[model samples]
Target: MSAFDVRDLLKAAGHPGQLKAADAVHYAPTTSAIPPAEVGAPRDHGGAVSPVVLAGSVRIADLVLVVILGFAIHHIQLADMVGLGWRYPAAILSVAVLAVALFQAFGSYRIAAFRSFLKPALRLTAAWSLTFLVVATVMVFAKVADHYSRIWLATFYGLGLAMLLLERFALLHFVTARMRRGQFDRRTAIVGGGPLAEELIRALEAESESGIRIVGVFDDRGDTRSSSVVAGYPKLGTVSDLVDYARSTRLDLVVFTLPIAAEDRLLQMLAKLWVLPIDIRLSAKATKLKLRPRAYSYLGSVPVLDVFDKPMADWDIVTKAIFDRVVGAAMLIVLAPVMLGLAIAVRVTSPGPILFRQKRHGFNNETIEVYKFRSMYADQSDFTASKQVTRGDPRVTPLGRFIRRTSLDELPQLFNVLKGELSLVGPRPHAVHAKTNTTLYDQVVDGYFARHKVKPGITGWAQVNGWRGETDTDEKIQRRVDHDLYYIENWSILFDVQIMLATPLSLVTTKNAY
Candidate 1:
């Protein structure tokens, strides 16, 4: 037996006996561990699972939190009251606060852990029970047990646990059902097809609860480096093919499990793939040092390096959708009277339907029939989105220019938000054939497709910031895309509010509008 440094191995593993002292595959610890560029390369360390997932899991766990905290506090109160007979009320509020904090710290309400509470959950409950017991014991030792109410104390402890567990059970059922329907699933795709990709597939397959369904893998290389089968998932196509596939596929995540050492090739791949509207992550399993420890995340015992994270994953999308509908509905209700007047004006001015419908690009470049109040001569209306309406244009009726300038023509789009085809605020969508000069916007701009990352809106950051109106020049459309991209990069509810507030003021400026 070679007397190796077992302690060092244990320390590296962060625990004793996790691994035996062995020579194993030791290497020089002094090289830059960047991700590989090419396909079919063997990636080293499994990349860390996202910590954002953990934070999200903690928030979701709050579904069962209120009950859990209530129970623990009640139990403590009941015990204090039973001991003190009338003083339990004084201890109730303090105990409740402490229980909630302890629950949060102990990861008692983590969505992953809460999904099953019997084995780990049983341990969690027991641990908390002991914690509360110590607090009760300390109180007794301090001679403060006689003032609490006996019945109130007993009821709180017994009822709190029951409610917490019951609520958790209900929440688990709701979450699991939504997940099964792909309603709560993270749309996942794999990049590369070799040993590393195989490991990722196996790891994901093993964790059924992780809710990752591999859409497919994209590899640039042929069979020599890239396998037709990594684990069991088939190679969907090449890296360039992935660009097209992403546009068409409902992919939520793209995991590039490429080796970090292949820097040149990776940059090339990033150039082609980074333009899409999905979460991109580089897998760090094959790196030499497994990173500086902070880079890797622990998913059970497996440590992984995180490359890129997709924005608005899982519940964030749900929350945003909720916010959209609530705000959209309220706005429509508030603006109903104004919309009614606009409808009447459109009908009286143009002897046609009050609404004008035109096909336009929406979320993911999908064509949606966008509605607007008619603002031009019904017969001469540019429904095909071909002509730019210039100032002093003959195409516009007398009523048309006023509504167009005031943006009263946009009133019908509120119904689009009502129909779930649009959001209240987002990048204003353009017509499918919308182009600057002779070239289309998508072909001209390198990452123009990324603007479709989220849903389109009636009023956008671009419009509110005076990037709206006719795209008469290359510079015009380019500035609009830039502002749209900026809006996407820093979107929030407050950001939307600011843009909405600025829209009316922006309409008054009228720099580009015809």
Candidate 2:
């Protein structure tokens, strides 16, 4: 009955839920037929289903996948120089997965984000570098790091970059071709049915990316004042009819081409249409202040400031993913000897299984089993820690104390990297019940849910900077959360590299690494 969460409304309705019985919902194949919003922007009389947008997206994904996967195989073959007769496939697969991740993180597939290669290219380099550094640093710290060769790492990077460049070039050519034929168009409409809407529609019609197809305008004003044709787009219907047309068609954006100075009327319109799933944007040309320089992004050289961006919208995510897999797999192959040793030690020292696994909150608040060495006495390993580990804790085994301190106990979780529950670098995931000062971590931090916006890490920004181990105090966890938030907000490949480098120094000083 509800419109659902603003973020999930469109996405959820597409799912197989019997959400609103038969007449309550309307469906159309956007890939084939997109209804018009502006009178001037009509569907092709030629009856051709435009394939450019879909084709471009799919081709970009495929090309990146192949190149990234292929280069990873090459890297593994090089790592085979370390005599890994069996671990090679896993290592390569890890790289393949991370490469995909990096691509996703970087938003390589997003339409607006990828229009310029300059920013995205630099980001790709940063994301891949950080991923490699994180995996390699962890392996070296564990003391059995000689399983990989530098030559293969070099080869993989070189080949991967070459493929990336080639793929982007090919994509550019293809996208341009589609634009030429008007096959990849973002059909948009204005709601105000005013002079501003007409101007905004005209402004968008003049740009590339196949330019926007401006559908007819919508206004409730009587015909005498609000004419039939507004900015060359006919007044299709009233606001109610606009909603109906919206149900029957595919519209990428709905511009509220009204000035903020007209506060009362704008508020009324927003209340009426805010429930819809499409991007609701305000045309910002009339604003007095030049918002933050960075806040304004050009829509064909006309500056429109950002409001709600699609989360992990583009290339930034794509690149981060690439880093995760490539480095995650490398760690698994290089640290196998250490992990195998830890497994044996755990079995020898305790009655239960070798690995310690527990439910920890992961990306998007999903409950995930995080793997570690069974450090506590078998019958007493706390699924939710009743007490924090301290110096000379009796619940810890003799072996557990040493492995936990050296962090060798965490080696088996390199597979968690392979499993995709954890990233090579992120805010380390905490148990669902993890708390400080008798309060859950989430309750104490105002933006705690924001952390779940990203994948949790095995070793994170806080951990590497001496915030590891038990959270015995409120301030301790807050500081850690502060650092974690800092990492998330100001994330870059270089920052990740710095964290990886600092981890060793920080670990050796594990004064609090209970």
Candidate 3:
């Protein structure tokens, strides 16, 4: 934790003088606690699942069903009436796209709609019908109806509707089963235990379909001021304990029920809570400050100001996973011969294993074993990287010097990316004891652990921007952290592609690595 003032931020929000000089804020980043064996490990806690994932899966499933069934009906039932040409195939794809858009417009893909079949079934039917109507209109206007069969269109509509209904019913059953196992619930916690907390809890419970399960409440006050329990939920611990609990549990959203006017307390709380990779929101339901409708978002009708949103959520996660797996596999296959040659050269030249594994802090502070080709003498290898490798170090082997300088030793980590322990582009992970000037990296930089919010990568914005190499000075690490934070804040698939493409040019131009 590092102490600083957030007065500037508060002033920008039109609220100032909310804190005394003594109440300095601390931005926290802690050390990793897990071991090397759990590399790319899944979180131990289980139960709650992301609603966005469920909704996205259902939407994709709808598209596949409609496209597959449309082709099936055309081939098996309408081959005689409809000619085999691009017109019918084009129509099926257009209907699938249109149906999906209409369903989204009707709110049929919402999380609430997934938990039941009747509402989604009705919405699906209407959307499907409208899709056919719109497509027919377009065909008629384009004078392309003569090439299509009326019988094919009618049969496709009826079959698509029945198939969609059946899929919805199956999804309803699956959701019900998962809910019974507590998988659909969002494990939420309130960060205040006074009257505001009680009111917020009551309001949340009123919406039974929201799937938010309030695990407990946390407050800094003693039992004398804040009761042991509020609105049937216990005060688990103080605000500090909440941080530890969230790291170890499957906690989803943390809502602050303290008054919006309590700016000092809110700032102090956010300083500590912002490091965790979870959603942090400030309750605005009972606040007197009025803002435009766009400033506030709703969670079951209760307005909240989003303080921090968990990154790489929902479709972002899906997109990154697909990119990493597909691209990583292709790279591995393309580089197989080079990797094999390096492996054999290392074995013959040095008396050690070809690959070296070292534990580094991964996403959410989990310790993961990152792989690299052996680039040092077996007897002098640094497992923990406690001492920074300097220029002209004696531990480097003849072949090691070439590989280390060119970053060819890092090629083995393509395996880590494929295994899900690393991303193709993100903040680079550091050794557990990596430091600058005899001080740990986290101790030197405030909120340093924030970089672990996403998976560490084989290449990153910092490396491509000329920040790769030994961190013998404080300034080097600080610059790296600054660039890493920038990448996280402004991340996209295209941004990642840009970084990866520039990586080779960076390797050739930079000379700091030893």
- Writing each residue's lDDT as its tens digit, candidate 2 over 282-399 gives 7776466668767766666656654333233235555666777888888788888878887888898788988888888776556789889899899879888556788899999999
Residues 149-174, model 3: lDDT tens digits: 88889999988888888888888888
In each prediction, how many residue pairs overlap at the backbone (N, C-alpha, C within less than 3 A)? 40, 32, 0
lDDT of 1 by residue, 219-331 (tens): 87877877876777667667666665555445666777778787655655655555455666666665555467676664333456554344344455556667778888898
Candidates in order have lDDT scores of: 0.64, 0.63, 0.80
Q: After superposition, how far is residue 506 of candidate 1 from its true place, in Å?
A: 0.6
List the candidate numbers ranked by TM-score, top first: 3, 1, 2
TM-score of each: 0.77, 0.50, 0.87
Q: List the candidate 3 regions with Cα displacement exceeding 4 Å.
A: 1-49, 85-87, 126-148
Two-way lDDT contest, 1 vs 3, winner = 3
Worst 10 residues of 3 by lDDT: 20-29
Give RMSD (Å) of candidate 2 vs. truth.
17.6
Model 2 lDDT, residue 177, Cα: 67
Clashes of 2: 32
Query: Which candidate's lDDT is highest?
Result: 3
